[model samples]
Target: MQDQPLNAADFDAIESTLLKYGDDHSVLNPSELDGYFTALVSSPEQVDIAEWFPGIWGGQNPAWETPDEAKQFIELSVRHINTLARQLAEDSAAFAPRFEQTEHLGHDVTLAEEWCFGYLRGVAVANWTPLPAIQATLLQAISDCAEQDNFELPQDLDVVAHQQRVAAIAPAVRALHDYWLSQR
Candidate 1:
């Protein structure tokens, strides 16, 4: 699916069951997606990229509450997408392309919806596609793999290749990226 703005309703539905802390937008800022990679590279050095969130056990108490839950949300989204990737790689032949970007890969809306709004919501409220662009890419790639019965994601692949796979899966990634930048 192409990148689109998630209105208040989408956010409301996601945060509906979760306990409200402070301003939900601050806790679930879309800008985190851009800052995440920078934070990963600048470890040990302090940055403004931080937020309060729940505890390790999924508890969101008063004292231990994290200021931002972006990291948790990204991790959850990544795990969901990676699982699909591994599955596609394991059975490469059974997959097929879903997006027109690549020969076989195509967009996978179900994977995107499930991971973005479903699994990610389990931990903290997320702003939908604003966070899961990377995950969405992976899910699309997995969908492509599914089209072919002999498709398999390479095990020894590096991060760049993984990114290429994601890019190929979703042409909308650029739109998503631009939307993310607009959110900043």
Candidate 2:
């Protein structure tokens, strides 16, 4: 079966539909959502863009910067990342392309949710900033993952195999993660 090609337009349609339904169960505020979308549009990356579609990880980029700047970037990045993740959890259809297997759907979602949250928190706390909202977004993403009790298969989607793909980018995320951890 051909994988579903879910792009920005698909997500935008999903968002519009959700808004028309008058649901506010999103993990982020309006501005944060905007920030996430803006980041994607301005500079498309793999890890983040993959977030809009299910079962696909747009492998996270490693960050590099001075101590103070790193802290600031972490806070903002977490806020934006969690916001997009939250939107995914809220509207699964928009992301159904990623979850192609029923048996491990829940597990995958949970992993993704936790990974995003843990990575966000790990980076944020590592930086030691007073960005409470960023922390809240991370917590919220975790909560959303916890609330899911079932799994579904992603239809016609592209799967990002973490192992096969990390070859080129592991150093960056690790360096960023380690740098933040070192501050503690």
Candidate 3:
């Protein structure tokens, strides 16, 4: 439950297990999965995890070889995700949201694009609404990310520039969280 309790090996283990169990049917990739949990717990309103867990499961039939494995997976995932949410909202300078596994966003836009989708899903399912202008603008930026597949980028912003834009999403998420919590 500590910040970044899962090292690379731990992450690999979890991801591989989930994938083996058909969790990839989930639209939220790993980074967005992190964002989803973070958004839920960061919300000003109380969120019932029990109610939301099924939605997070995303209708993926359990493919774990053993039922116990499925149970343990859910328990571990929930614990880690709750820890992530708390750490992100605390805004410790040492901690950043784990939107991607590597230091860089990626050579392509897909990770951020998936991340935006996941984050937006969290916001939507949590029913966080009527966002203030700044947060709304940030959501708009994320929306642009969501459109990465269909929308054409200007020729000037090459892959490097696109990656930089994706990397910039970390701060935008922080700002959105700050904006929402300020109402308290």
What do the candidate models score in CA lDDT, each in turn?
A: 0.32, 0.33, 0.63
Error of 3 at 67 (Å): 3.6
Best by TM-score: 3
| Candidate 2 residue-wise lDDT, 18-137, digit = tens | 344322333222222332232232121224333432211122322333565434433444454554444443442332111112234233321233233333333332233442474444
Q: Give residue 99's error in model 1 in angstroms.
A: 21
Give the runs in model 1 whose Cα sits over 4 Å from its true position: 1-52, 55-124, 129-174
Candidate 3, which ten residues in sequence have the lowest lDDT sum? 101-110
In model 2, which regions exceed 4 Å deviation? 1-110, 127-153, 160-170, 178-184
Question: Which run of 10 residues does model 2 get worst, by summed lDDT?
Answer: 53-62
Instruction: State candidate 1's TM-score.
Output: 0.21
Error (Å) of candidate 2 at residue 29 is: 25
Tens digit of per-residue lDDT, candidate 1, span 1-184: 1123234553343243233442343223222221222112112221121321332113343332453454444344344233333333354343322221222244222212211222233213232332466645643453453343223333443435444643453333333334433454
TM-score sort, best first = 3, 2, 1
Compare candidates 1 and 2 on lDDT and give the better one.
2
Which candidate wins on lDDT?
A: 3
Instruction: Estimate the overall C-alpha local distance difference test score of candidate 3.
Output: 0.63
The clash numbers for all candidates, in the given order, read: 31, 13, 0
What is the Å distance of residue 118 in model 1 from its true position? 12
